[model samples]
Target: MWNEILHRSWLRLEQNYHFNDSQNVLNVLKQAYAESQRAYHTLQHISECLFHFEQVQDLLGDARAVELALWFHDAVYNPKASDNEECSATLFQDLLKDDLSTALLAKISQWIIATKQHLPSSDQDLNLLLDIDLAILGATSKRFIEYQQQIQCEYHWVDSEIYQHKHKQVLTHFFLQQPLYQTTFFQDHFELQAKQNLTLALAGNLK
Candidate 1:
C-alpha cells in the first residue's frame, strides 16, 4: 500500500514538477524539512496533506498544481519573519524557471500565500491546499497535544508573553470563525475536535 502510494506520488510529481535535476530536488526537500520547527507541519506535514489530498483528489480541478504548491509552500519558513510565504513563493519561481510555466508558477505562489490566511479563494484547488495545510487544527486530543509541542519548539527563541499572545490570537481567530475547516473533507474529519482542542488550550493558558 505504502509503495503504491509512494509510486503514485512520484508519478504525480514527475508529471507536475518536471525538474530535471534530481539531486537539487532532494536537497530542496531536505532543506525545507530541516528548517521547519515542526516536523509534523513541515515535510511530514506536506506528506500527510498529500495523503489526504490523494484521497479527495477528484474534488480539485488542478490537483497537480496544488501538490506542487504543497511541496514549496513551507520551503522558506522563518519563525521570526512574517514574509516566509513570499520568500517561499519567490524561491519556487526562481527554481522552477524554464521548467514550469509562468502562469502555473503564479498559481502555485498564490496557493502558498493563501495558507497564511485560511481563506482560500473560491478556486477548489487552492482551497484544498490550504485545508490540507491546516489539517492539524482538527486533530485528535493526543495528536493535537503533540502538534502544540511541535509548534512550541518552532518558536523557542520567542519570549513567553509574545508567543502566548500570538498563539492565543491564532487559536482565538479560528475559534471565532463560523467554520474552522473551510473545506468539506476537513469539516467532516476535524472541525469539531479542533474547536474543542483550541478552546481547551486557550483555557489552560488562563489558569
Candidate 2:
C-alpha cells in the first residue's frame, strides 16, 4: 500500500517536475522516510498531505509550489536539530537546480520554513499545508489522543520535566493563536477540538 502511494506520487512528480530519473526520486523518498522517527513524518505523512491537497483542490489553484514544499517539509526532520527546515529547504533547492524558477523555489523554501515558525501569514498555500500537517489535531477524540501519544513517544529521549515544559509552550502558543486554523476546512473541523486538546494538555502539564 505504501509503495503504491509512493509510486503514484513519483509518477505525478515526473509529470510535473523537471526530474527525469524515477530511481533518484525514489531513493530520496526512501532515505528521508527511513530517517523519520514516526509514521507521522514518514512517507505516510507525504501521501496523506497529498490526499488532503487533492481534496481541497479548489483552494489550491496553481499550487505546485505548495505540493513541492510538502515533499521536502519533513525530508530533514531531526528532532534534536533546530535548523532542520533550513537544511531541508536548502537541500531541495540544490536538488531542483535550475529546473524550477528561482522565485518559485524561494516560495517553496519559505513555505517549508513556515511549517516550523507557524506565524500568522497571508500565504494561502502555506496556510493550507500547515493545516494539513496539523489536521490530526482536529481528529476524532480517540485519534487525537493517539496523536498525542505518538508525539510524546517521538520525544522519548527528553526527561519528563523538559518535555512537559517544551510541550506546554507549544500547546500554549497554539491555543493563543488568533485562529487555530487559517483555512475554512480546518476551522470547521479542527479549531475547537485543537483548543480543547491544547487546554487539557496545558492543564495536565501544570498539574
Candidate 3:
C-alpha cells in the first residue's frame, strides 16, 4: 500500500520532471516512516492522511503539492526533536529542487510548516492539509484510544505523570480553537466527534 501511494505521487510529479532516483527516494522515505521508534508518526499515519486528502481533493487548489507534502510531513520525525517539520521541509526542497518549480516548493514548504501548529491558513490547500493531518482526533473511539497509546509509546522516555500533564495542555489548546478543522468537509464530519474525543481524553477517561 505504501509503495502504491508513493508510485501514485511520483506519477503526478513525473509529468513535470523525470526523476531517475525516484525509487531510491521512495526507499529512503519508507525507511524513515518505518523507523523503530515511530509509533503514531509512522507509515500508517501517512496513509491515513492521504486517505483523508482524497475526500477533499476537489477542494484543493494544488492537489499535487498537498499530496507531496503529506508524504514528507513526518518524514523527519523525532520524538526528542522540535525541528522535524523544518528538517522535513528542507529535505523535500533538497530532493526535489531540480524537479519542482520555485512556487510549488514554496507551497509545499508552507503546507508542511502549517502542520506544526495545525492552525487555519488563508490558503485553502494548507487548510485542507492541516485538517487531514489532524483527522485522527475524530477517529472512532477505539482508534482514538489506540492513537493516544501510540503517542504515549513514542514519548516513552517521559514519566507517565509528566506526559499526561503535557498532553492535557496540548489537547486543551485544541479545545480553545473555535473550530478544530477549518475545511467544511472536516468540520462537518469531524468537528463534533473531535471535541467529544478531546473532552473524554482530557478528562482521563481514555488514557
Off by over 4 Å in 2: 1-5, 36-39, 205-207
Q: What digit string (tens of lDDT, one per residue) describes model 1 on residues 1-207?
A: 544554567577886666787458657766777764654547667667777778778898987888778778888887878998898899888877768888887888888888877784778777778778877777777777888888878889999899989988988988898787778888888788888888998898322
CA-lDDT, candidates in order:
0.77, 0.76, 0.86
lDDT of candidate 2 over 21-75, digit per residue (tens): 5567568867887774764577767877776766775788556667777788878
Q: How many residue pairs collide in each prediction?
A: 0, 0, 0
Clashes of 2: 0
TM-score of each: 0.89, 0.87, 0.93
On lDDT, the stronger of 1 and 2 is 1
TM-score for candidate 3: 0.93
